[model samples]
Target: MAGGGGRSHGLSSSRSGPTSNLLFSCGKVAIVRTVKSGPNVGLKFHGCPLWPVSV
Candidate 1:
């Protein structure tokens, strides 16, 4: 039961995006992603675990 209007500005501005084993601003676990198919393949990025994507 969440709306799509509570997205935070800080989440979108995360240039680093999806770091491995990192903590979000809310103290949650971070979801890191590795590029498997791109020029920057194998690159790791950091992201928040509690981002309101479907707020």
Candidate 2:
């Protein structure tokens, strides 16, 4: 289970093989959070405004 901002993300899978189920489950949750928050976070590029700049 993964918790953030009073929310919880959980998963259940029953497949075992070369792929690690535990690792895949955790990675999925991380990806979701990253994608959800990525746009709101600031960019690392130089000379760029937090918001877009228009002429």
Model 1, TM vs. native:
0.36
What local lDDT does model 1 show for residue 16?
75
All candidates: TM-score: 0.36, 0.16
List candidate 1 stretches off by more than 4 Å.
1-21, 35-42
Kindly provide the TM-score of model 2 when superposed on the true structure, using C-alpha atoms.
Answer: 0.16
Using lDDT, give the best candidate's number. Answer: 1
Off by over 4 Å in 2: 3-10, 18-33, 38-55
lDDT of 1 by residue, 1-55 (tens): 1356877534333457545344555666666667679798998866565544785
* Candidate 1, pairs of clashing residues: 3-55, 4-55, 17-45, 17-46, 18-45, 18-46, 18-47, 19-45, 19-46, 19-47
Specify the highest-TM-score model's number: 1
As for candidate 2, its clashing pairs are: none
Give the per-residue lDDT digits (tens) of candidate 2, residues 10-48. Answer: 444457753434323334412222222466564232111
